[model samples]
Each structure stands twice: as C-alpha cells, then as structure tokens.
Target: MRIVVAHNRYREAQPSGENTIVDAEMAQLTAAGVEVLPFIRSSDEIPTMPTTAKALLPISPIYAPRAQQELSRLLTEHRPDVLHLHNPYPLLSPWVVRTAHRHGVPVVQTVHNYRQVCSSGLYFRDGMICQDCRGRALGVPAIVHRCYRGSRAQSALMATTLAVHRGTWKSVDRFIALTTAVADHLRDYGIPDERIVVKPNAVPDPGPPAPLGDGFLFMGRLTPEKGLDLLLEAWRRHPVGALGPLRVAGDGELRPMVEAAAAERPDVSYLGQLDRAGVRAAIEASAVVLATSTWHDVLPTVIIEALASGRPVLGTALGGIPYLVGAGTPREPAGTGPASVASAVRGDGAATLPVGVVAGEAGWVVSPDPAALAAALPVARTGAAALAPAARARYERTFHPDVVTKQLIDIYADAARTAPRH
Candidate 1:
C-alpha cells in the first residue's frame, strides 16, 4: 500500500509525543511492508525561514499556498492510495485535506488533541480545564484569553484557522482518535460515529518484562498540566521513604519546581531530561509509572511506554488515563483500599467510583486532587509488583506496534475503498 504520511513536527528542543508517535508510526508502516511517502515540516524551520517565508507565517495556518502547491504537484505525480495526516499547523495547514481530495486521494487524519476548537489544543488555561469555545461558531474565547502560545494575535489567528477549517476537517474520509476520550471529543464536535475510529498510539515493546523495581517514576514534560505539581504535593504529603522513592524525569517550564521538590525531600529525586536509553533504564528501575495529567491529554505516550515495559500506571482519572488504566474492574474485587470502600470522594466534593482492587494489575486511578492522589500512592506502591503481567498483556493486546499498525492498515484500506475513486 502506498500512503503519504504528512505532519508538522514540533521544535526539537522540546519533547513532543505527537512527533515521536508520527516517527514510530512511519517506521512501523515501513517495517510492515507498506510504502510510506513522508511529507513533513518542522517548527524549528520558522527561525531560519527566508524573509518572505517568515512574512507569510501569519496566514499559514489558514492556507499555506506554497505547501498546497507542493502537495498538489506531489499528489498529481505520485497518486498515493491514501494521504494520512497528522499535525498540520503553521506550515502544512489543513489544506492538505483539500489538496488530497482534489487529487482523488483519500485523507485520514489522526486527531492528536483538541485543536479543532481550543487554540492551544490542550482545552486548559490558567491551571484549569477550559472549553469555552466548544459549541461556538468561532473560538472567540481563545482569542480573548490568548490561549495559543500566550499571544493574543497568535490566538486570534489560530481561532480564525479553526473557524475556516471546520468544513475542511469534517470532509476528512476517516478520523483516527488516539483514545476513546478523543473519539468522544470528535463525536461532540459533530463527527458521525461511522467516520471516527478509535486507534490508540503504540510504542515499541521493551522486550520481556523486567523485574519490578522500587518506588515510582513520573516521566514526561515537567509542566503544570502534566501533573508534576500534583505529584509533588502528593509525594510531600507522605512521610519520606513511605512510598519507596519517587524519581522525576523530563524537562519543561517546571524544572525549578521539580528541582526544589527533590531538594526538599530525600525521597524525591529529579533525573533531569533523559535520552531514550535513560528513559528505558528509568522505567526498568521503577515499579509504577505515573501519568498524572491535569488536562484532557488525548494520549500521553508515557502511559503506553509504561505498559510496554510491563509497568503498571497510577494516573489521574482525567483524559485518557482512566481509559488507559482500564478503570471498570475493581482492583480489590470489592474494595477501593484495604477496607474495600464502595466509593471515594474527590476534592471537589463529588463522589467517584473506585478502580479495581487495591492491586488491580493495571495500577489505579484517582482524582487530580493532591489528597486523592496522595492516598492512592501507597496502594499503588504495594500493588505494582503483582500488576506487571497484566500491564504487559494490555500493551500487547492494545498498544503493541504490530497490533496497532495492522489496524491502521485496515483503516487505510477502508478509507481508500470508501473514497471517490480517481
């Protein structure tokens, strides 16, 4: 099968799960004997773009004429069976959908975030989940709050881009949602159930399960939304060495916060930003992986990585975490903790259901609250060892590259068949 995999990559200085996933997917497809024609743009080029190119950046999101012309020529020449789109922002633009359609090529897009409406793609602002523009015709709230890169002008441009591309997005042949939460978001955005497919991102399996390690590991971009602060608060709530040792990794806006936390307590150790080898090593040395995103993170790849490594996860009940953790089963069969509580209360005074037995194999899920998360840490610590096999099994069945890639190939074939033949 011939497929055009197009994406706009984030800057290299920052770690982007979307970028990593795109690369992995391309490699996986190639290994599976599919011919992948990559059409990629990087944000790092913005700084080095020619003067004229820089001037056109403001309107690129709405329509990148040069990108369209190039893609048009490519489509006309290659005529790939399907054009699978990933991130299309300031460089590629959603015009690729129109371009592919014009060439009679089917277009399949992977929904990476909430960028269809929210300017920042996070649906979060000012340490709170914000979706003020969900059902609106235009994302005026995004412009007002400067949700895109913290620039009012940029946010306005992004909002305009979202407004202009509503039809462009709807016209897509198929939507690959990385998580059920993302699929639900697409439904809420007016996409029909038939057009949307739930396909979670996959990571390379880290071979066989390693021996369970000590303490816990929270690895990702150390940002506020990623739940670094909440993890620290929960860690601090417990006495030192109570829940083994907490090792923090990754670099972001909250590096100082992580450093301070590590300094304040001997149990908390910040490992700084790690390379792939270091990450693997860290995961091998940890028991439970913490994916505590405070926002609606569509699919934080870290959670999948943990599963691949045979490590259980203790993640926030928000976004894709609960879904990733398989929260329906009771860890205790009839208990939330040792006492088997029927329900747990959140910091917001709302009652939430328990996730499996205390050591449900896939770890636990709790509210994003410090208190709720703090209370569950020890339970997870106690249960991490037993959860290894199930965690690895979940990865193989759901997120292993072989499984996800075949599903994607099928989606591509379906999209090609259903599309208007050239």
Candidate 2:
C-alpha cells in the first residue's frame, strides 16, 4: 500500500518522542515493502523564514487555507492510499484533514498530545497538572491564563485553530491513541469512542538483559514538566547512602539546575545531551529508570526503552504511566508480573500477564511529590530484578518493530478502506 506520513517536527533543541516514533514507523513501513512517502516540516526551519512569515505563524486558523492547498497538491501528485498525520500544530493546522478528504485519501491522526483539548498541548501549568479547560471551550480559560508559553496571543491562536477546525472532525477516519486511558479521555472531550484506537508506542528489541548497573538513570528533556526538581528532591531525601548514583541523560531548560544539583550531590551525575546510542547504552547500564513527570503524559518512549532493555522503571502515577504500568490489579505489586516477564524475553515472546500490565506494567507509580518518590525509591531498588523479566517480555510482544509495524499497517489499511471517497 502507498502511504503518506506527514509530520511537523518539534524543534530539535527539545526533541519530541512523536518525532522519533514517526521516523521509526516510516522506516518500519519501508522495510516491510510498503511504498512510504514522508512529508516533513521542522520547527527549526521556521525561524529562517522572512519576518512576515514568522509574524503570521500564530494565524494557522487563517493560513490553513494555503496549507490545505499545498497538501492537496501533494496528495494529487502522490495519490497515497492513506495520509498518516502525527503533529500538525502552529503551521500545518487541522485543515490538512480537509485536504486529505479533498484528495480522496483516508486521514489517520495520532493524538500525540492534548493540543486539541488544551491550548498548551500539555495539561500542565505552574508545575501542576492543569485540566481547567477540559470539556470547556478551548479559548475560554486557556487564553485567560496565557497557557501556551505564557503568551496570551499564542494561546488564543492555538485555541482558535482548534475551535475553527472542530468541524474538520469529519475529515479524519481514525485517531490512534497511545493508550486506552487517553482514548477514554478523548471520548470525554467528544471524540467518538469508536473512532479512536489504542496503539501504544513500541521500541526495537535491545537484545538480552545486560548486567544491571548500580546507579539510577533518568532520560528525557530536563524540563519542569518532567519533574526533574522532584527527582532531585527525592535524591536529597534518599536514605543517605542507601541509593546508588543518579545519572541524568538529555538536555533542556533545566540543565543548569540538573548540573548544579549533580555538583551538590556527590551521587548525581549529569550526562548532558546524549545521542540515541548513548541513551541506549545508558538504559542498558542503569539498574532502574526514573520517569518523574508532573503532567499527564501519553506513552513516553523512555519508559518503553527501559522495558526493552530489561530495566525496571519508577514512574509517577499520573497520566498514561499508570496505564502503561499495567491496569490496576491488587494481585501484583506495582512494577511486577507479566509485562516485566514479557519484556525480558530474547525475542518475540508474549507477556504472561494482562495486556494492560505488560505494556503498562514494569514500573512503580508514586504520587507526583518528591516525598512520594523518596518513599518509593527503596521499593524500586528492591523490585528491579523481580520486574526485569516481565518488563522484557512486554517489550518483545508489543514494542518489537516487527509486531508494531503490522498493527500500524492494519490501521492504515482499515482507514483506507473505510474512509469516505471524495
């Protein structure tokens, strides 16, 4: 099948998991012998444009007509069976859905974030999960609070774009949600339950379990939403000398803080801005992965990567992490059972536990507080080995490229066949 995968990448200085996932999916399709065409736009390229163009960036609701024209032309030329969209904010806009419909290509969108419901994209503000605008008019409270980057105008523009294109809902045939919790959340916002499918992010097999290291590892952008401060606080309170060293990989706005904290704490190590290979090595070497996020995140790639490497995770019990850690069952302890076992397997093995835990399991979820994280640290350290096998088994079954590729292909094919003809 001929597929056109279009994505507007976030800026590279702060990379997004969706960008990685889209690139991986495209590569997977190509390897499977599918004709894959990628249409990519980068945030880095936008800054180089003329001032007038830059000034108009916030008016995506108005400029969407031009974007639709361009997309329609591309579709007319490529005639892709399906148009898979990842992120279309700021520049491309939701009008791309209409363009795909005009060109008789089925549109399949992945709700990578909550941009449609929350103008800030993340339901986070002032270091807390802010859902004040949920189920309300997009611009109502978000604009009042200047949610997006603390700019009222930008937040208003995003809210308007979502409001204006709310009618474009008919243009999309399917919405691929990273977790069922997210799908249900979208449903609460009026997106049809039947139109959304739960397809968690997957990671490549990272071979067999390596010897677990001594230190705890944290990977991801060093940002406030990621709960880096909380991680640091937890480290400070960690039963002095009871915890191993803490290594932070990746860079962002909070780098200086991370560096300072590392300097202050002898056990903390800041490995600033590691490449993909370096991140993989870090995951393999770490005894446990820390996902101390303050917001309600969709599926985080780092969590999946940790599982694929046979590492246990200590995650915040907020947003999609709980869903990924496993459905809440009293039978198993947090971060134990089938998911960990499944992710530990050498190759293509099914997790023995329920699907929810296998993909969602293999992690400990604590309250988003530093005290809570500190309280959970000992548990994470002690449970790491017990959860490794199950975590690995989950990775083999759900995240293996060979397995996830087929699921994506099926979704694309179904969208193509079911989408209305122009």
Candidate with top lDDT is 1
TM-scores for all predictions = 0.93, 0.90
lDDT of each: 0.86, 0.77
User: What is the alpha-carbon lDDT for the whole of candidate 2?
Assistant: 0.77
Candidate 1 least-lDDT 10 residues: 350-359
How well is each residue in 1-422 modelled by candidate 1, as lDDT tens digits? 99999999999888898999999999999999999999999999999999999999999999999999989888888889999999998899999999899899999999999998889999999999999999999899998999999899999999999999999999999999888899999999999999999999999878998898999999989778998878888788889988988999999999999899889899889998898999999999999999889898888898899999999999876787777877632333333442343554333343343432222336677767776677778778876776788999999998999999999999999999986653
Off by over 4 Å in 2: 327-361
**How far is each candidate from the true structure, as Cα RMSD in Å?**
4.2, 5.8
lDDT of 1: 0.86
Task: State the RMSD for candidate 2.
Answer: 5.8
How much is 181 displaced in model 2, in angstroms? 1.5
What shift in Å separates residue 72 of candidate 2 from its native position after superposition?
Answer: 1.7
